[model samples]
Target: MTTQQLIDQIKIKKSFLTIGLDVDLEKIPHHLLTLEDPIFEFNKAIIDATHDLAVSYKPNTAFYEAYGIKGWMSLQKTIQYINLNYPEIFTIADAKRGDIGNTSSMYAKAFFEDLNFDSLTVAPYMGKDSVEPFLRFNNKHTIMLALTSNEGAFDFQTLNVSSASGSKELYKQVVETSQTWENSENLMYVVGATKAEYFAEIRKIIPDSFLLVPGVGTQGGSLSEVCKQGMNANVGLLINSSRAIIYASNGTDFAQKARIEALKMQQEMEEIMNLRFNV
Candidate 1:
């Protein structure tokens, strides 16, 4: 989907929520396990239940990779179902993949062309050559990792590095340098909600760019604070909530319970949008 299309959905839904489909077999309803493909079945139920309440759905690739071939098939079926049923909803392959230039291109093709994800999460540690390949695909966004939500982010991302403008956080340099690459307009970023205080400074560097924010709800990040600090004219944020929504229950009413959780966030997001942009 184009950036304008994504922005339009955010307005139409009055939400910037991205539901993470990080399905764990252990946590899913016991009844689902009897189905041939429990992971996909679980995802289908969740997607069907909360599709309207969210503008995007992200499936962290590691969840599928863990189950091997059957898991991969489940991942394929889940993405296909979403594309066929709700093509308007933005989809993300939450595969934080980055490699040498050639390898990156193949990875890009796998997710962008084959799976047909609207976006893919990419690690920037490999630098421009590794990321620019993914950015080459038209209308497909490469969401680079920036000030992430994890505790270990301070080990590298926040470390001061000498630059022409004097010392600055490594993440600041990454954001600054990325804009100079080809097709940089297609770039979005991963800015963890836990690091909400850093949003203002990050916004100064790339005010117009979209940010895929995780770490809310189960991770204890504040929705209101992230929106207040990170939002731009386009309401440039995709606040992701995974465990808190999808794992709301492990019974037959799991999908219904998931919607209730999603609805709470959607309503909260709608209120934020109304107050912020009067949409």
Candidate 2:
């Protein structure tokens, strides 16, 4: 999907919410295991229940990778279901893969072409060469990890690095440098909601770029705080809530509960967009 298409969905749905599909075998309802593809079944119900309330669905690739071939097949089934039913809703393969140039291109093809994901998460630790191949795909987004919500982010993301402007924060350097490699049109950064305060400064560097923000619900990142700091004229944020939404209940009512949680977030996001952009 193009950036405009994504933003249009957010507007049409009155939501910037992206539901994360981090399905755990042990966490799903016991009854679902009877199905041939429990992971895909869980995902299907979640999508059927909450697809209208959400603008995107992000399936973290590690969850499927852990289960090997069967898990991968489940993920494929889930993607096919989404593409067939809700083509306009953005799909992200949260694979966070980054490698040498040739390998990166293959990874890009795997997610963008074969699996048909609209975007994929990419790590920027290896620098431009590792990330640019993913960006090369037409209209597909490369979500580069920036100031993450993870606890270990402090280990390096904040380290002061000297530049012409004196000491610059590491993440600021990454965002600035990456912007030089590719403009915001096809590039989005993963700015976690736990690092909400940093969004203000990051916005100064690239105000219009969309941010695929995780950590909103289960990770305790405040939705209001993130929108307050990160929202731009274009409503440039995709705040994800995973366990809190997907596993709202371990019972058969899980799908409805997920929709309830998603609606609450989407309603708030609609109000935020209105107050920030249309007001």
Candidate 3:
């Protein structure tokens, strides 16, 4: 989907919520296991229930990779279902993949061409050569990791580094340097909700770029705080909530319970949008 298309969906739905489909067989309801494709069944139910309440759905690739071939098939079916049924809902493959230039291109083709995800999460530690390959695809987004919410982020991302512009956090440099790449307009970023304070600075660097924010709900990040500092004129944020919504219940009413959880976040996001953009 184009960035304008994504923005349109956000406005139409009055939401920038990205539901994470991080399905785990151990945690899903016992009844689903009896189905031939429990993973896709679970995802289908959740999407059917909460599709209207969310503007995006992200499936962390690790969840699918864990199950090997079956897991991959489930991942394929889930993305296909979303694309066929609700094309407006932006899809993200949270693969966090980056490699040498040639390898990155193949990875991009796998997710962007074969699977047809709207975006893919990419790790930028290998620098521009590793990421620019993903940017070559028209309309497909490469969401680079910036200031993450993980505790270990401080180990590298937040470390101060000497540069031509003087000392700055590594993550800030990552954000600034990425804009110089070819087709940089297609770039989005992963800025963890837990790093809310950094949003103001990050925004100053790239005010127009969309941010895929995770770390709300189960991760203890406040939605209000993140929105307060991160929101731009276009409401440039995709707040992701995973386990909290999808695992709301392990019972038969799991999908309904998931919707209730998503609705709560969507309502909160609507209120923020109304207040911030006067929508």
Candidate 4:
């Protein structure tokens, strides 16, 4: 989906919530295991239940990769189901992939062409050559990692670096340097909600670019603080809540419980939109 189309969905739904389909077989309802493809069945139920409450769904690739071929098949079926049933809801393949240029191109094709995800999470450690291949795709997005929510982020992202302009933090350089690459307009970013204070400075660098923010419920990132600092004129944020929503219950009513959790976030997002944008 194009950026405008994603923005339109946010407006229409009065929400910018991205529900993470990071399914764990161990945590899912026991009854679902009876199905031939338990992962897909679990995802289908969650998607069906919360599709209306969320504008996006992100399935972290690691969850699927763990189960090997069957896991991959489940992922394919899940993306297919979303595309066929709810084309308007943006799909993100949370692969966090980055490699040499040729390898990156293949990864891009896998998600953008074969699987047909609207976006993919990409690591920027390899620099422009690795990430630009993903950005080259038209109407698709490459969400580069910036200041993350993990404690380890302090190890590098926050390190001070001297540049041609002046001294700047590493994460700031990542945000600034990325804009100079080809087709950078198609770029979004992964800014963890735990670093809410950084959103203000991050926005000054790329105010219009969308941010896919995780670390919300389970990680204790405050929704109000993230919205207060990160929201732009277009409400440029996709606050993702994974475990807290999808694993709300492991009982037969898991889907319903997931919907309830998503609804709570959606309602908060609607209120923020109304107060901030008057939508």
Model 1: per-residue Cα lDDT at residue 187: 97
Candidate 1's TM-score:
0.99
Compute the lDDT of residue 172 as modeled in candidate 3: 95
Clashing residue pairs for model 3: none
**Distance from true location, Cα of 234 in model 3, Å:** 0.6
> On lDDT, who's better, 2 or 4?
4
lDDT digits (tens) for residues 1-279 of candidate 4: 989999999999988999999998899999999999999999999999999989999999999999999999999999999999999999999999999999999999999999999999999899999999999999999999998999999999999989886899999999999999999999999999998999999999999999999999899899999999999999999999999999999999999999999999999999999999765
- Better model by lDDT, 2 or 3? 3
Clashes of each: 0, 0, 0, 0
Query: Following a full C-alpha superposition, what root-mean-square deviation does model 3 have from the true structure?
Result: 0.6
lDDT of 2 by residue, 1-279 (tens): 889998888889889989999999999999999999999999999999999999899999999999999999999999999999999989999999999999999999999999999999998889988888888888899898889999989999989998875689898888888887853457899998987889999999989999999888778799889989998877899988899999999999999999899989888887888778765
**Tens digit of lDDT per residue, candidate 1, span 247-267?**
999989999999999999999
Model 3, position 76: C-alpha lDDT score? 99
lDDT per prediction? 0.95, 0.90, 0.96, 0.95
Model 1 residue 190 CA deviation (Å) reads 0.3
